[model samples]
Target: MSTLQIGVLFGVVTFIALFSGMPIAFAVGGVALTFMLIYMPAETVGLVAETLYSELDNFVLLTIPLFVLMGAAIGKSRAGGDLYASLNRWMGRIPGGLGVANVMACSVFAAMCGSSPATCSAIGSSGIPEMRKRGYSPALAAGIIAAGGTLGILIPPSLTLILYGVVTEQSIGKLFMAGVGPGLLLTALFAVWVVIRFRQEKARVLAGDESGATREILREEGFTWREKFETLPRLAPFIGVIVIIMVALYGGWATPSEVAGIGAFFSLLMVIVIYKCWRWPDLKAILGGTVRESTMVMMIIATSFLYTYVMSYLHITQEVAQWLVALPLGKWGFFVAANILLVVLGFFLPPVAIILMVTPIILPALKAHGIDLVWFGVIMTILMEMGLIHPPVGLNLFVINSIAPDIKLRDIIWGTMPFIGLMVFAIFLLAVFPEIAMWLPQNVK
Candidate 1:
């Protein structure tokens, strides 16, 4: 069969497996194993073993579990509550203040916990209801959280960025640096959108209110200077954790793994000290979450490597690359097409799987087009962020639905739509001015 035919068959079978509800790791591995046996019959076992072992045999991979642990410790505990509560008190005095505060909290939490669902869950739990109580429409409240949570992958110490760097053989630090600008930009955009959306919702509420009950709900119960300052003590530890992580990365004080460990340890200590969550159940929940997430990610990474190896051995990736480059489109046109495909793929696959499986196949074409890998990493991370809030596989959407079951899934999806547009606009801005993502990575030591 032609390499094209084989590649088509490989993708069809893999998608079928995935849509049929098979786990991603097993599905990818199964298709890969099947193809390997068909192609390398006698050498299938050896090839699979070798590829799997070599791909994961990196010290840097340890950072995944440590990062997961840190997020889990904070996310599974009261740290998220503390983080959100403090921000809420400070931001609650103004119109749409809760929403602006939610965006800020999500951005800071994203830096600490590199998991999108975790950030969504951690922030959404309190943000949504509080917004609801404060007369923020349920859909808008849900949307703020579902969208803000996506920052987890675009901020530094991001898992998706780490995986992208590893798959593309780019510097993890540079990828992290590239993300900082876009991350902050997206955060600001989310906040701005929240303010706009809040005003719209407030107008509707005021117009529709027959009684003053709705107005009362929208009323701001002001916090005193002392009350706002009281939250600072509760929030300082989480801030300290973020500062430590930033210092570790930008200061060149430690490797990624070391930073992950330090962040995890401190986050754990904060929960235990503040929440007194030293019970075995608390520790067990944290460790259990860490192990499950780490194992799932690692498995997907391994299977994706096996899938890549199969494609490479069959010359499918090279053939695809040649095909992509031969298209009549110029580099910018190529980017538009590639971004469309990545966004579509993001709708179906998790960022880690896409980073591992799709990146290898596209790397040659990307290099041929003179695209910077760090910039592409940030761009792809934002695309994946869209996926996190988008439907079908929109983890953050479901996370919001779970947190605020009173809010319908459809409404939650609607809520996140505006934020999705903001992400697309962010992409457009980056395309027009590449420096938005490149300046930090280029100028930083």
Candidate 2:
């Protein structure tokens, strides 16, 4: 069979396996192995072995586990709660204030955590309840938290960025820097959406009320300065983790892997000393959780490498690269096509799976067109962030729904529309002003 035909068949089978509820690692690995055995010599075991070893051997890959551990530790600590509380107090006076706080807090939490699920859980647990207490609609609260959680992956120290860099041979540090400005921009956009929505809701409530005024509602929900000050110190440890990781990487003090290790070490220490929340048993649980999550991520990386190896061996990647470049579209057209394809794929696959499966095919095409890989990496991360909030298979939607059971799925869908619009706006902004994603990386180095 032609390499193009083989690539098509492999993609179809893998998509089927993914939707069948099979583990992604096994699905990708099994599909790749099947094709390898059918098309290549049995002696090709070395191919799989080398791919697996090489994928894991990268120094940058170490950042995945370290960032995951740091996120897990902070997710379980009191800092998340403190951060949410402070944001609530400061932003709560506005209409939909608590809902606004949820988005703000998630942005803050995203800086510390890189995974969507952890971000959803950490910010949702604290912010969701507060929103409910403030009389915010459940659907609105859930939608905000779910959509906001995606910021975790778009912001710096993102594990997804690390994985993309490892697979595409892009600079992970530069990718992280590229993500910073776009992440902050999206966060601000979400905040504005929350404020506008809050005002509309408040207007409805005031119109419906005969006895109570808006002032009464404000009096009841306003946060005190003392509440904000008390939570200030709790933010220190989380800030420390971010600073250590960024400063170490940008300052040439440590490589990404070493920074990951250092970040993890600091995370553990902060949980124990600063937060004073980890007992021996808690530590054991944290370790166990870290191992379990890290194992899942590493397995995906290994299997993705195996799949990439088989495709490369089959010359599929090169053929696809040629096909993409041969299209009528110029560089901008190719960029548009790629983003559209990724968004469609996002509807079916996990972000990591999508990154692994597609980057091998797409990166070569991108390089051939002289597209900046660092900028592309940030764009890809933002696109993945959009997928996290999208319906049916959106991971962040499921996360918030699970946490707030009373929230109907439709409400989650309806509530996300404005934020989704903001996300799209942010994407266009980045496209028009590439510097939003490129400036930091360019200056840092």
Candidate 3:
């Protein structure tokens, strides 16, 4: 068969397989194996084995499991609940403040755990029920979390950024630095949207456009400063973890792997000591969750590299790069096209798979256009955040639905719809002014 025919078939069949409900690792691995056998000679099959081995051979990949363990330990602990309580007391005094606080808490928790589903689960567990009881609408409660949870991937210590670093060979520390500005920008954007929605609701009530019960919510009871400070000791340990990671990375005191190791150990220790999660089962649960998540990511990474190998062998990668360069579209035009492709791939595949599998094919074009890998990494991570809130495979959406079973899937979907636009606007802002994501990474010593 012709190379073009092979390339087209590969995408179509892979899409069908991925969308068919099979495990992502199997679907991706299966595609790689099938194509390797049919197109290449039997001897080339050995290369597939070699490719799988080399993919996981990097020392930097160690960061992923360690970070995952840190997140898992936190996820299994009471730190998340404490953090939410602290923020709510301080930020929840205003009408819709709880929702804003949820966004803020999600951003904080995202730094604690780089996994989106973990962020969604942790914050939504406490945030949702609390918001509902305090007169917050179910849609507002669920939507805020589903949208806020995307912060997990954009903020520092993020797995998506780690994976992007691994694939693109960008400086992980610099990438982490790059994420800070955009992360805060998105957090503010999400919070601002919440504030506006509440204002609109209050305006409606004043005009008798809606019910008046929301007025009482608008007059939410305020907490004293002392009360706000009281919850800090409970949360200080978790915040300390974030500080250690930041200082370690920014201070140049440790490599990404070393920082992850230290952070994970301390996070585990903090939970055990402060949260008293010392029982055998608690330890077992944290370790087991870490292994499960880390293994799944490793499996995806392995198959994605193999698929990348086949793409290169089929001349698909070279063809695509050349095709991209041939476009009359300039640099900005390329960004537009690339963003669209990333969004579509994100809808079907998780960020990890897309990063590993797609990056190799497009790297040449990025260099040709002189696009900053760090900048592109932040953009890609933001797009991945959108995918987590988006449909058929929206990981965060399902996470919210699972935790808050009372909130229907449709509502969660609706709740996330606006944030998608917000993310798009973020991408726009970053594109127009690259400094938003680059300034920190560039200026920091």
Worst 10 residues of 3 by lDDT: 210-219
Q: How accurate is candidate 1 locally (lDDT)?
A: 0.87
What ranges in model 1 sit over 4 Å off? 209-217
Model 1 pairs whose backbones collide: none
User: Cα RMSD (Å) between model 3 and the true structure?
Assistant: 1.7
lDDT computed for candidate 3? 0.88
How much does candidate 1 score in TM-score?
Answer: 0.97
The deviation in Å at residue 68 for candidate 1 is 0.4
**Cα misplacement distance, residue 323 of candidate 1 (Å):** 0.3
Candidate achieving higher lDDT, 1 or 2: 1
> Candidate order by TM-score, highest to lowest?
1, 3, 2
Root-mean-square deviation of every model: 1.8, 2.7, 1.7
Clashing pairs in 2: 96-198
Worst 10 residues of 2 by lDDT: 210-219
lDDT by candidate, in order shown = 0.87, 0.82, 0.88
On the 0 to 100 scale, the lDDT of residue 346 in model 2 is 88
